[model samples]
Target: MPVQRGYRQACGVARGLDIVGERWSLLVVRELLLGPKRFTDLQQALPGASPNALSDRLRELADAGVLRRRQLPPPGNTRVYELTTWGHDLEPIVVALGTWALAAPPTPEQIFVSADSAMLTIRTYYVPTPDQPAQTLQIDLRDHGPAGTFTAHLTSSGAAVAHEPPEQPDAVLVTTTEALLAAFGDDDVPGLVAADAVITGDADVVRRLLSSVHVPPATDPR
Candidate 1:
């Protein structure tokens, strides 16, 4: 589909931009990277976006074949937007973009970070190590507006996160986004546990997992 006010360039990057260069276009795709989300979920994730603006972006993305809306079956009937097969292909691109952004300046204090974005942090900064044994972890993030449960798989090569709980995880970390970020950025598990964070399983798994995250420093160096 043709985008409005297109760059009208012949290059591949320009062409791709023409489709997703709008303000919140790529962010919309980012929210759906893990799985489908209801309109309310998107709103919670992107508080800066006006309802009308978000609607317009969603429509445009649907037209561009990046996402599709579907209704859930039965008792939990609700509409949700999910990335199409072609849309899911944007995951690596989004990850690369996020990784690229790590070199940029630190964000201002109290900036909002959606749960999906928090999960993406895991994917973006994942470091594989032979000493880091494979394990399944259940992550429960609360008080982040529409709390999220995720299952993370740490492998020899990489880590994978899904928006679902595991039947039997090797460890479970329950914490708020702030504490989780603190742990991720500083690997401060004991501090987190002393605060609002809770751990039900192997603490070493949680420690190793948090230590494995290589996020940019929260404070500016300059």
Candidate 2:
């Protein structure tokens, strides 16, 4: 691929923009945030982009040193793309952007998030309360089609989220995408449970986990 044009300016922000300013570049970064992905996986995660566009963006990001292509060893020897350490540093930026964007009401057109993206959104929106005791919970979230597992560790000071399941989670919650989204939309745990969402282990811990993340109302601009 031929080289793309730069901003031709000396500012740091401009330099940063020159590298990731192209459309779909950051979204590519978002797809790789959880881990490596094959080209087809990326295509599935970002269905809006054409294959050629995805390929070009990957090439651009690789050339910019934001991503690298590697081949898996032995059994699964397929080539996949992953972010470099520097690229991984973009997580905070992406999370912050998501938090900011959530304030806006979703339009009818927007739909679907990759399993990882949904987990990451939970991590991004989670806020620990001062009075709440520290706790850990595991979530086995299922969509109507696919499923994923995650763990959230919360404390009075802060909270952390991991893609893996906790060995001895204080609680485990299982729900579909629609139910989970509804929970996040209104902090409605009973509603979800009534709708067939399952809860195992300590119910209080699950409550704490759900309460930690605060999603603004649909009418709230801020």
Candidate 3:
């Protein structure tokens, strides 16, 4: 497939957009932020994108030095895509954009948020409280329907998500997407527990973590 034409502008923003402004390009970057993923995995994550469109976007990103395709070694010799060092630099930009977009009024229709996206939100919006001690809190966030597990490491510095579980997690919180959304919106611990969200190990750690999330104030719908 032929690559799309650039904006032909000298501005830095325009040049940056020329590389990643294409449809589904940034979404591809978002998916690879956590780790590498096979093409099929990318397809699954981005269900709205057609196969051809996805292929083109990946090609464009790779050409622009945003991502690279490599073959996994030995046991898993399948080809996977991962963000380059420069590509990883886009994390803060994407997080900021997501945070800003959160201020927009909600739509009538439900929005589907992937597990990675949810974890990214937690990482981005987390704020450390002066009262809370600076300790590492590890929590396992599980997506029941998709059956994927993500480990969140919370510290005074910030929060980070990993594909594998922490060797020694301070606590574990297992909940579905719906329950997570509710808890994130209201910081309702009891409500989540009542709804079957399981919390094991030190409950205080989970409490502090939840309390630290900086939810944006409600915006006027009008």
Candidate 4:
């Protein structure tokens, strides 16, 4: 369906597309997933969209009962957009699409996460470390849709990937695909702090691992 789809279509697909079929409409859902956001925050997340388009889409979505405008605490009179109970229903559809795409040929995470300009690398790995030499870390996440693939090399210099359980990764961090990009790309682990991405096998060793596997400063936005 093209961008102009209206609510009058007969088929369910047509009717459904009527809500999120616009160029940047579904992405509006994406920004909201992170949390309720102000209009400016949405604009920053959606760089290509115009303020007018965003306002129109937001208005339409609210009218359709998908999103709702909420007010923040007193003294801070800012308007934020949040998904209604009905809007939360779309999560499964998004996740199913992710699973469906995984069935196709696996190329790279970049292809799946191409929506955002930020190039990210997400990977799941089993790494061996000194503290917990037998542990393994399996990570999965992408900030963008379709998800991306990346290699989490053992950052222990010449130590190489080991087979021991606890001595390996110490902890496994699971998060959305962009966990790495935010940690390593934007160099902002604080962003995921709210989600607590670390999965600990050996708490002590995982602490060290966190410092070791970090992306270089070059990609650090903060």
lDDT for every model? 0.85, 0.78, 0.76, 0.53
- Residue 59 Cα positional deviation in candidate 1, in Å, after optimal superposition: 0.6
- In the range 1-222, model 2's lDDT, one tens digit per residue, is 213777788898778888888888889998888788899878877889999999999998999899999999989999999999999999998877777787788887887777667777667667777887778887776762333677778788776777678888888888776567667634567887997889988887766666666765556575
Question: Residue 96 of model 4: what lDDT?
Answer: 54
For 67-124, candidate 4 gives per-residue lDDT tens digits of 8999998897999999888887875665455445544554454333432222211122
TM-score of each predicted structure versus truth: 0.89, 0.81, 0.87, 0.49
- As for candidate 2, its clashing pairs are none
Better structure of 2 and 3 per TM-score:
3
Best by TM-score: 1
Q: Write the per-residue lDDT of candidate 1 for residues 153-201, one digit (tens) a residue.
A: 9987888999989999999988888778767845678898997789998
Which candidate number would show the highest lDDT if scored against the true structure? 1
Each candidate: how many clashes? 0, 0, 0, 25
lDDT of each residue in 1-222, candidate 3, tens digit only: 123677788898888889889888888888889999889888877889999999999988998899999999999989999999999999888877776776776777746667677677677778856554545444444553342577777766777778777777878888776577667645567878998889888877777777777768657645
Tell how far residue 212 is off in model 4, in angstroms.
Answer: 17
Off by over 4 Å in 1: 1-3, 185-187, 216-222
> How does candidate 3 fare on TM-score?
0.87
Model 1, residue 44: distance off in Å is 0.8
Judge candidate 2 at residue 11 and give its lDDT: 94
